[model samples]
Target: MSAVIALRAPLDEDLTAFVQSLRSLGVAHRVAEQGNEQVLWVPDEQVAAQVRELYARAPQGDPGLQPAHTSAQRARPGFLAQAKHSPLTLLVLALTLLVALLTWGGDNYDAGRWLSFVDFHIDGQYIYFGSFAQVIDSGQWWRLLTPMLLHFGLLHLAMNSLWYWELGRRIEARQGALMLLLLTLWFGLAANVAQYVYGGPALFGGLSGVLYGLLGHCWLFQWLAPNAAYRLPRGVLVSMLIWLLICMTGVFELLQFGAIANAAHVGGLIAGCLTGLLGGLLARRLQRR
Candidate 1:
């Protein structure tokens, strides 16, 4: 690759967006640190002028550079677009919906008994049986992560699913599906364990905790790696935090919003923040190297 342009130190949002544009165009490029500045490199000299033009035009709000789609590109269907953009997110959405459908509006559907990590009470004392024991004893290890798939109502499912799609797609698009899956499992497990610890064997389940984790991850990741595409608007961050505070204050319960898993939310946020911080530091280090 050859250096196309030397962008100024501390790259701005426009430049980062331009980089993403170049990537979307399938341009092979790399960002290399050069003393006090960073240079954008393209592999082909023939495309140097094109890259330069795009970079110049990007800041001026002309990002609609749609490349011609070939017969091969047009051969695939529209749903493929979602798969390509965020397959993991779509899969989770489908699974969550399926679980909700199976457990919703059915007199025999005991979501709490089936999905909660611990659903047993012995002599008025709640005993916690986590995934480890469940796996060893009953081989039902999915108990650890299944709580995230259980939603109390349509509103709960809709809100969590929307946020998961929004946040999960960004992470999967930037970091890949594997990272999203790992983060989901980590946040889900941590949140479930936290809720179980805080509220005992009571029924509590939802993806809100994992959603909070994604929020924190995106917020911190963007702060540490400004060039990253995982950008979250200030309003979103504020609204989510406000909701968290409200839940902690038991206002949701007072308003008949059902039981809010406040501890799970806290746990998920903490896990996501730590993950984001580490991810950012690692990305910065790799960039420097």
Candidate 2:
């Protein structure tokens, strides 16, 4: 895996000379544009040190090398690059959006009935059996995961999707797609079960649980692996924690923000923290060995 060491948009001639120097030194490297900046990535930290040394020794206007393509002329990596870097995150985002679209506007859709993990009744008659019971009775195991795909409204979908993208991508980038997938499933199951246990047999669904899980995972992983890139800004952590506290206080319902899944959030955070703690400890032990 490569680590980005420098982020600078060098002049055409300078970039050409730099690339030539790297090639001559047999250092593997790549250039990628992130937002408005061009990033220079080297596969090894040792190679990055050599690159820094070369830059320091070379003259500013060395006329030995020909001009290369400008940074603007280089093609910018798009969605495919993003997906490649964070496939699990993008896949989850796509599935969530598709489910949101399919179940839009209508509250009585069969999709929701099949996805939610709770049983609900009307007038003393069972309208739909609980997902957990159905899985045991009918072998429809997908119900455990489908709950995380359901969203109630546009605002709900937008907020959850935004957080998922922001947090999920970080985990996927730093950890791996497999880790992200496992964490999502684990968090989804724990959160859905917690919500069901706490408020039983009702309509509730969103990725807020998974979001909290990602939040906790990143929060703790950064503490354990300071050199790892899985860091969250302090402001983001504080704001989210404050919001969680506010939601738990039943303020959202009072202000007409609708019902808050306080149990799911708490359960997800706990599960994520545990997972992160274990992962961090394991990572540290491995590094020591």
Show model 2 residue runs off by greater than 4 Å. Answer: 1-80, 105-108, 119-135
Cα lDDT for residue 257, candidate 1: 63
TM-score of each: 0.75, 0.72
Task: Return the clash pairs for model 1, or none.
Answer: none
Q: How many clashes show up per model?
A: 0, 0
Per-residue error (Å), model 1, residue 181:
0.7
Q: What range of 10 consecutive residues in model 1 has the weakest lDDT sum?
A: 105-114
**Best-performing candidate as measured by TM-score:** 1
lDDT of 1 by residue, 1-289 (tens): 5445534445433355556566667888788555324677776667877777666766432346533564334333365686678888999999998888887822223554577675443344554444445544986677778888888788889999999988998899879999999999999998998997788666678899999999889888778766535767789999999989988999878989677899999999999999999998877667666
Candidate 1 yields a Cα-based lDDT of 0.76
Worst 10 residues of 2 by lDDT: 59-68
